[model samples]
Target: MNPLYSPTAERADNRCEYCHAPELVFNDLFKVEHIVPVSHGGSDNTDNLALACRSCNKYKADFQTGTDPDTQTTTRLFHPRQDEWSQHFRYEEEIGEVQGRTPVGRATSDRLQMNRAAQIAARRLWMQLDLFP
Candidate 1:
């Protein structure tokens, strides 16, 4: 068994940490992503791990920081271990954007490209299922 899988999955209740989709339904398609990539000196500890859907994981690969393309400001990605998700982001249904008011939130949203077309579509589905917050 992969050590990264057990605790990370459990921490998220077997759901995608980002979107909170049930893993049983998304099995084999979900991945354990490092909130801070190892390449950026992140550790293998549980604090650094997050359960992400395949799409999110692939999109977020090896990125510890990013620039807000809209504002042209650089910021660090959201650290699941150090930062609270709710504190950094809010969902806006009317515009379908994950509004980030904090540096942590804005950076993660930008770094992960969280508001991409596909992610927006996924969020809509998750919203219909009452899986999104």
Candidate 2:
């Protein structure tokens, strides 16, 4: 593991910064990811890192902008370091889905595939175990 990984996971409460799911619920350890791509001149500093699941990390890749499904507007993705999660997203525990409340949120949510079936199934189990949102 990268030495920086432990602290990044700790800082993110062992949850995915984007999906907000606990690492314990996943089969593999969560990924320590660059919130901004190193290819984009992003740094490896702790401030530029976020804990993410394999799914989110793979889906997000290096892109930070997408069209908002709700508005069809091109917008910047939600910056876990800069944007407040609650301000942009709302967790619907009943449906086990993260609802994006804003354009940026919706774009991020859609691009990240936050509501994919595999994720929802895992979240359902986590909720039952009292380890989820």
TM-score of every candidate relative to the true structure: 0.82, 0.95
Kindly list the per-residue Cα lDDT of model 2 for residues 80-107, writing each as its tens digit. 8889999999988998998799999999
Question: What's model 2's lDDT at 11?
Answer: 90
List, residue by residue over 1-133, the lDDT tens digit for candidate 1: 4567877777787876654545664548478787878888977788778888776677678877777666778788777667777788887886667867787677777766778887788777767777665
Model 2 is weakest, by summed lDDT over 10 consecutive residues, at: 21-30
CA-lDDT, candidates in order: 0.73, 0.90
In candidate 2, stretches whose alpha carbon ends up further than 4 angstroms from where it belongs are: none
Overlapping backbone residue pairs in candidate 1 total 0
Global fold similarity of model 1 (TM-score): 0.82
Clash list (residue pairs), candidate 2: none
